[model samples]
Target chain A: MDWRWDFTFDVVLPKMWEAAGVTVWATVASFVLALIGGLILMLLKTHRSPWISRPATEFIEFIRATPLLVQIFFLFFLLPDFGITLPPLTTGILAIGIYNSALCAEVYRAGFQAVPKGQWEACIALNLSTYRTFRDVIIPQSLPPIVPALGNYLVAIFKETPLLSFVAVAEIMQISKLIGAEYYRFTEAVTIAGIFFLVMSLIAAFLIRLVENYVKRSILH
Target chain B: MVPRIAIVIGLAAFLAGLSVATFAELKMFLPAILRGAVVTVQISVLSWLVFMAMSLIAGVARAKASGAVLWLAVGYIEVFRGTSLLVILFWLFFVMPEFGLTMSPVLAGVLGIGLNFGAYGAEIARGAIGAVPRGQTEATIALNISPWNRMTRIILPQAIAIMIPGMVNLTIELIKATALVSAVTLVDITYASVQQNQLHFRTVEIFAITLMLYYCFAQFVRFGGDALEERFSRHLSKRV
Candidate 1:
């Protein structure tokens, strides 16, 4: 019924700041993992052999189709039974990273597909090795367009960090829930957390847009 | 090629064998999981309808409405899009009760998913509408068509065609998002599987089923959306 400015500023704000660090760290770490995993998946799917590509494609599809929350739960709860227990933070990052890699893989694949067949033919005609073609010819060309899409996933994975809370990772959402339970006042803590998320998302979106424009302009030049 | 085919068949047999072993344990949990799957479908469908309605309203407002309405629509989209859906669900379920605006867990889930995805849908809608071309709207205006008629008869058909692919992506995302409803204590498939896993300690078997169910649902959305888009744009093809 009433807003508690004092409580929000003195208590919730400081706690959320600490939690925001964890949230940011988790997001960045997972994003790095996603980038690597996604590229690998994309390359596998684009392999010349169907034996390798078909299963890789199917794996990516399976991950993309499933929910991140379920994946997190599966990893957190089930892995322990196999004597493969991970720290909550590790599990959180791995779960989110693996889940998002599928999406990023699709983006990468699209990026690859968008390159004209002429480019590949030219590489072949020039006697470029496969590695040289991908590194020198394909990758640089494919990357710019994919940057914006990857950036979207960055923001997306950031928003999804809250799900880590479900598995007991002390991110902003988890901390806020604790604050709510502790103070018996849900409004201030939850509202502050929401505000934090909103601000971060807006900033990420702005940065991504800036990067997209810069990439476009550089490509044109 | 022969080796590849053999490998594929070998992999299939291995998976079938694994499933058969798991099924012996999974058989008892099938009913609960199925019931949860039904709930997942229900939530996705219900939330999708709400999301579509909100998107249409917000999207149209953002595209055409004047001044205050336009800002309000933008505000809605940004706030919902920017905030985490889990936080929103928690706020709806926990914080709203403090203000005497209590919602049932299911309602909270629906509202949360609907609002979140609706924000995304608004952007898609705006883009699709914008892509309908200036000439179409100009011709409608030249004909002195009513504003509603201009949108419905002239602009919307084309916009809807452009919108369907994006809408399908959003729908699939929404279906995946429905899993979050379990956090709010809704008996969705994710919740049911989690519960069954906790009880039986059969995480691999249970979640494997959950994953397959979600994949099937997503594929259905993809196929269905493609079919609808084909139907909607059939006239364009005929004209060509």
Candidate 2:
């Protein structure tokens, strides 16, 4: 195996670092959408009315049942057919956001359900509105604990950013692919991209654990 | 209960509308797509086999073994789990050739998905095995049960029940990742659907069927997992 350290450091690492910004940007942007979008979906699914609840449940199921790659394609390729032409990067972010939103909804549902039936009963006993109850009680209890899971999704969104390269977003994976094609050397660029993902996600996971501990401490005191 | 009936009726009406609207196009493409589904299932099943093997060995090693074996297993799980599956796919397919190792696209795709999901599966395995109570181990020791019998009869059943749902989730994810094989030009269902879209330029009809097909595959996997879990957890009683 022909490996070149000097060539990799001098030539490819800079390009990869620039592209890493785009990857991280897409992860954070899509993750914001996922957090909000997931809560909305979860609220709808848990609504008292069967009409809203059933449809939300079905929509979440449909999204979860299908693959994200096709969803990305469905957005990037199919939307233009209906005259909604988004930029490639926007398309990628929207697709990832929408796809992971369903996942995040499941996470929220698990956390919300784990809050114990007594809490919900007490809220009902006190005649609290659903919004007030969730905002004041249920979500506060649930969201903090689920931070680590959500953070895992953050890393997940980071991993999914590579799929965005398919639609020509010029993210890290795309840039690495182009570099490999141009330089006839796939090893350095691809391996470096892998390392970028590994290091950033490990850091994210570590930070998430610290946040979880701090949240726990503050809750206790 | 009312919602369940409504959902059934709603789904029927939706399918009726879809058939009325896109019957001709769907008829033309579905057989081709189903054939591609065979390819997808082939890749999924093969990769699942490899995933199971890797998960079992590495997961057991991580949970129970010590020293180099444990570290090696830990390294396997983290390195593969840490990065994107597509990177692994591309590495195996594109970069491995540079390192004097060559493989077919199908082999690379299978190995990529297998190795990636195997790492995730190993995590589930380790967690499940670890979830087996220490009391159970003490009980086995007190009863003087053989090691193999203790694991097979007492611990593994509970652990399997604990981990089945997670394994099923990973299997569904594996099936979804099979769609990535299309990027590597494997002519799986995703590729076939894209091919149909390329030919007819009918986006809505093709994507609906494509998505539905994948959804069915996931439901199928979930069905199997549910049955397995039922068998394993029969003694646990109905827990909410």
Q: Model 1 over residues A1-221: C-alpha lDDT tens digits?
A: 88899999999999999999999999999999999999899889999999999999878877887799989998998779889978999999999999888889999999989899999999999999999999988987887879999999999999999999988899999999999889889899998888889998999999999999898887745
Per-candidate interface DockQ score: 0.78, 0.78
Chain A TM per candidate, in order of listing: 0.95, 0.92
Scored against the true structure, residue B19 in model 2 reaches a CA lDDT of: 72
**Interface alpha-carbon RMSD, every candidate:** 1.0, 0.9
List candidate 2 segments past 4 Å from native: A120-136, B1-28, B235-240
- Please provide TM-scores, in order, for all candidate models, with all chains considered together: 0.92, 0.91
Q: Candidate 1 local accuracy as lDDT?
A: 0.89
The 10-residue segment with the lowest total lDDT in model 2 chain B:
B1-10
Clashing residue pairs, candidate 1? none
Model 2: colliding residue pairs: none
Candidate 1 segments exceeding 4 Å error: A126-136, B1-24, B238-240
Docking class of 1: medium
Native-to-model Cα distance after best TM-score fit, residue B210 in candidate 2, in Å: 0.7
